[model samples]
Target: MDLSRPRCRLWRELVLVASLLACGIRQASSQIYITPDSLIGVERYSSSLAIENAPEDVQEYSWHRGANDTEENLIISYNATSHSRRDGPMYSGRESVSIRGTLRIWRSQLNDTGNYTVRVDTINDTQRATGWLEILELEIPQISVNTTSVVDGEDAVAATCYTNDSHVQWYVNHAPVSSNYRMTISPDNKTLIIRMFSRFDSPLQCGIEILPELIQKSDLVYVTVAYGPYSLQLRSSPTDFSGILSAEIGSQVEMECISYSRPESKYRWIHNGSLLSFSEKNITLPSLTWDQMGRYRCIAENSATQLTLYDEVHIQALWRRPVVSRSFTISGSLLVFLIIFTVLGFTHFLMVLIRALFRHYSTRANWSI
Candidate 1:
């Protein structure tokens, strides 16, 4: 649908009169013509219809609300000499005739829309003119928002008041609101512009005045407001410097990451480019070891606004207490002790060998002879 086009409709149509002259059908140009050949009337409003360009010495005029067959419904009649006017019984009070051969209808309704004709009688000739009237039916107005949901930083949003007529008003949470510096309304009072609005604002409505005693307001519509995720920060409870952490073996590790967003936000932690086992806002590693060292990224997402914030972190395990180094030094000491002991034993053996040889040679000469 094209929103810029006018919704109101006023239809006009030509209504030809039936043959009334005794001589047969006559040309339309020879008949008396109404000032406005066709017209449209609004419900409950008064409008007029008149005869014009009639020949001189016109004696009388009679008006009918339908085709020639419906002449009994003579709504109005005028006599030039007596300067008097009369109306039919059906139009006793709602319709009247003017002194100058015109018809006045008050409080027009939908049923009043139809073809009408007027017969003019003069001393020289008789003529007839035909016209039509279309009465418009009023309807209830409606209100619509361009979008049901919007981001906070949007430049503008439109709240439209939809109706056939130009008269309209707006409301917020049942309270009357008008165009201002922050809000603007179109010239036809059909569209309202809003510069900004938060989720805390109230619902909107559109209204119209059907009559002096009745005011019609449309159903309320609530809008949603979305914000962003900002200020992303991630850190461990024990503390680390620029994504570096020092934790001894068999020690528990705890880290907390957060970001700001409206309607809260969802958090995710990634370790070494993979999703961390922990689903909560915090990431924890049990008994920190060298294997835990890697890049840690915390992602914060705002679902409503579809915005995200991320921060990467690196952690390293710092060795505390040189227990293993001291144990390795003791093994080196044992090796040195074993080498010295082996050298001392070898020296003792050489000495024992020399002593044994000396004793055997000294005792062997007398015993063997």
Candidate 2:
């Protein structure tokens, strides 16, 4: 072997050894830290935590309630390097050496509320972290009205209240209503239902109160009571048909009569004091003959209230017969006679001319002879 070749191989081996040492040192120096070792909003609940840089084989992990390690609450003993799991009632992850595990607490119940801690152990060193869990029980109850408005005479309207806590009460118009018979509280005590048989036309108030804590009120809803009599009024196109007359017999006539009351109005046609059979919004007679000609009247009435209104129409019959007098007839006859006389006179003159011509012809012949 050549010396330079051996030297180069030795240098390469040294370089490789140095690189390995650097990587080993870096790995050894890298340590896991849990950010925010403590947390709130954990609200008496168990939460998850993230463990970072934990030894690849973390055999045992411990959890406790207090800062002193003496009182230990061993939650889990697992073998994993970088792992995450729910530690407390609240699901917040922890990665610092502080609290690397979740702490469980009952958020609604005030009992299981306190400081929580978690410790991670890797054969050589142990890391610890802590967090606190709080409890809140105040919650607003939900209130709802069945209907925004109720018709008059309608009764037993239901209003409902919902909440997280079981203790709930019902109220109407700011007064506490008994939750015994008319009002009912759900078994969970979270929902309160109230029913009232109300006749007042004014708006009624309803609300729900979570026992000793939260109260929610519903907006007022009105009830309408309707009572009225049907009334009729004749609404003619020309409200005043005072001077209208002599309408063509065959023309379409319109007479409008509308009921100004809740129910619709009924109408009947009357002509010359006789009640006609057909009735409608607009009365139309196809062809108004002489028999059907007379003073027409429209009677609009509300059957319920017996209220009636009348609209009269005067229709003049169309006289289509020829109206000529005796004098006119005689004059026409005389004119015809005069024309005949003139024609006869012209014929007679022509005949005379023919006869004269014939006589002249005969005389000329005699003279020639």
**Which pairs clash inside model 1?**
243-314
Candidate 1 least-lDDT 10 residues: 13-22
Identify the runs in model 1 with alpha carbons over 4 angstroms from their true place. Answer: 1-142, 162-182, 195-202, 205-220, 239-245, 262-266, 273-279, 302-304, 318-369
lDDT of 1 at 252: 87
Instruction: Quantify all predictions' global Cα lDDT against the true fold.
Output: 0.70, 0.47
Error of 1 at 223 (Å): 1.2
Q: Give the winner by lDDT.
A: 1
User: What TM-score would every model get versus the actual structure?
Assistant: 0.39, 0.30
Question: In candidate 1, how many Å is residue 65 off?
Answer: 42
Q: Top model by TM-score, which number?
A: 1
Model 2 Cα lDDT, one tens digit per residue, 15-126: 1110000111112335543222322221222333333465654645655555533333434333345444324323323212223332222232444346656566677787
Sum up the clashes in candidate 1: 1
